[model samples]
Target: MIHLRSLQRLTLAQRRRTATGLRAGTILLAAVAATLSRAPAARAAPEPVKVVVVANFENGADQGDAPGEFQFWVEREHLDHPVALRGAPDVLRRGRDGLYGMVLRHGVTDLAAFILDPRFDLRRTYWLFTGISGVDPRSASVGSAAWARWVVDGDELREIDDRTVPAGWPYGLWAIGADAPNRLPSDPNHFGSVTELSQLSKAFPLNAGLARWAFDLTKDVPISDDDAIRRARAAWNGFPAAQRPPFVLMGETLGSRRYWHGEPRTRWAEDWVRLWTGGRGVFVMTNMESQTNQEVMRTFGRQGLVDPDRIMVLRTASNFSEPPPGVPVTASIGDEGPGQRLAFDSNERVGAPVVRELLAHWTRYRDAIPGRP
Candidate 1:
């Protein structure tokens, strides 16, 4: 049974096209409000932060101990004017130099409101979404990281119960205007399908050039793996990516709040990302926050509050969305281990270098995109 509150919020966003998929019928969690107010991010016309590090949640022991996401990004920098936004708690950290950091509450509402906040000077900043997510076992393993080239929304679709779906149907899901799975959506532009490609019915493509540059810089960085992950990965000895030690890769991501799992859902995620990107994107990570974040950018991009070209998303594998060959989905759903720590470590490893570069040469990046050296 779907949560009434979840469905209610979804309905609200669809009705109010620009609504931040939050506050439709749901109350904003205090966590979201408290996070941004912790420091007090403010400034009428203060110096613009060059880079902003965005992390979704602070859970587990690593997160509890660290001052912020990726640890060093916050500890090493000095933040000023922690202006708290009313609709959401958007804590902005001004690096000891010129960088910034924010820990986002795990929801679409806060994500959208923060950018629209008057205090955020996104014009001269590089918004880097740094977080961990579930990886497709066929594509990656714990500790592996990916730079997203495209972000697809998997939630905007019509569906029938699997039990009542027609024969040969993959699942009960299909495009909003399409007749069946894998078919062209009839009303691609019904709402905000303006960018829908022939193959993708609901999606957004970030700056391809920027994604390439980030991938090129960190593709070869050595990713540390551990015995816990190795032993966990042993269950998937047949899958090359899952068996190999963690590494960095360039790929695409999908975001949805449904949190479905197992092979069928995994296949849907892969196909959805591929179909949306028209075969150019490789699907790897599954996220819950990116799609909402993208929506906010798209909404404000028109008002000159945001630059879609200046944004990038980085995802690291904390666990597989589905169990391996023999493990059941039920067992894998709640199984816990060191994947959390590995995810934190790898996310920082793959993303820190880029953050450092932007901080070191803020003058060059403030007015221009950096070229690959």
Candidate 2:
């Protein structure tokens, strides 16, 4: 009886050992399978294709004001590739300001979204922003279109009261001249001083075909009518020192009131321009009346949308300069009215030629630059 009981106990112990081995094997197999399943998912995603984004313009005449208006027209009329319109979100969110935020809000919600969204190919896309900017009174006249070399936030400068306190500003007109060799140092408040694609032949290389196309398209378009020039010069002659708007005052005031105090504006301008030019661009606008241009351009640069070499700034005349003591005074011609109206319309009419040139240039640039497409 005792031998039989011991035999039974040994048999039970063997069974228990077998069961323990089986359970251990099962657990080990499950862990190995789980690890293998995650391997593919852990791989990094591919880079997204570059895309140009144009947002709806906030101000100006609705007809020619929106960035997308010109961008869509140009893509349809000029580019051979697909151009997609990004939707604008209504909810105002924080952490997005200037042109970067505008592109994010209106075109693509985020850069990552642009990368992951099935609609866009990660490896083959790019973007550009196209729109009109107010000409600096000192340098460029009304009706002239310019490409940015650099975009600086006018509000980033120091200010006092409602005026921009210029003592330690990082991106004032003076700083612009110090950076760009082609720019003249005379007028600091003017937008024309910003470096443009036309001027930066080396660092921000221009596609010769593109430059030729831009020149050809814009060449025939009259920059100024004789009558308009006469009127502008006449208006300047008439304005007295006390009545004339000061250029420095314009920059200072714009920096203090509009850009510094409020939610950052001007992201659309920066993003679109940066995308179109492949990352190097600049902007020009009145410091006092419209920092929108400056703010937007600056935002694009900061966002990595633009290539660093392709940046510059330019300004026209300073509205801040006081006229001579005895000059006759007339109402300011700064506003875009009847005379400026024709300039915007002319873009639509002559845009075909410009489109042709742009396409040709883009093709040539793609060919010249090894990795661009």
Q: Which candidate leads the pack in TM-score?
A: 1
Cα lDDT listed for each candidate? 0.70, 0.30
RMSD to truth, every model: 6.9, 20.2
Candidate 2, which segments miss by more than 4 Å at Cα? 1-116, 122-127, 162-233, 238-284, 287-334, 337-340, 346-354, 360-363, 367-373
Candidate 1 TM-score over all chains jointly: 0.81
lDDT, residue 77, model 1: 45
lDDT of 2 by residue, 43-99 (tens): 565433332333323333222344322333333333333323222223111111111
lDDT per residue (tens digit) for residues 1-373 in model 1? 2222342334322323333224322222212222122224564564455787888776432223743344544544444435455555444445566666777654545554465444467776788888778899899888899998898887768778889999999988877677788765766565563555363445778887888888888999898888888997888968889888999988888888677777888888888787777778878998777786776666557656667788899998888888888888898874434587788778878888888877887777778786434
Considering summed lDDT, which 10 consecutive residues are worst modelled in model 2?
Answer: 27-36
Candidate 2 lDDT for residue 315:
24
In model 1, the runs with Cα more than 4 Å from the true position are: 1-44, 60-72, 76-90, 106-120, 188-201, 371-373
lDDT of 1: 0.70
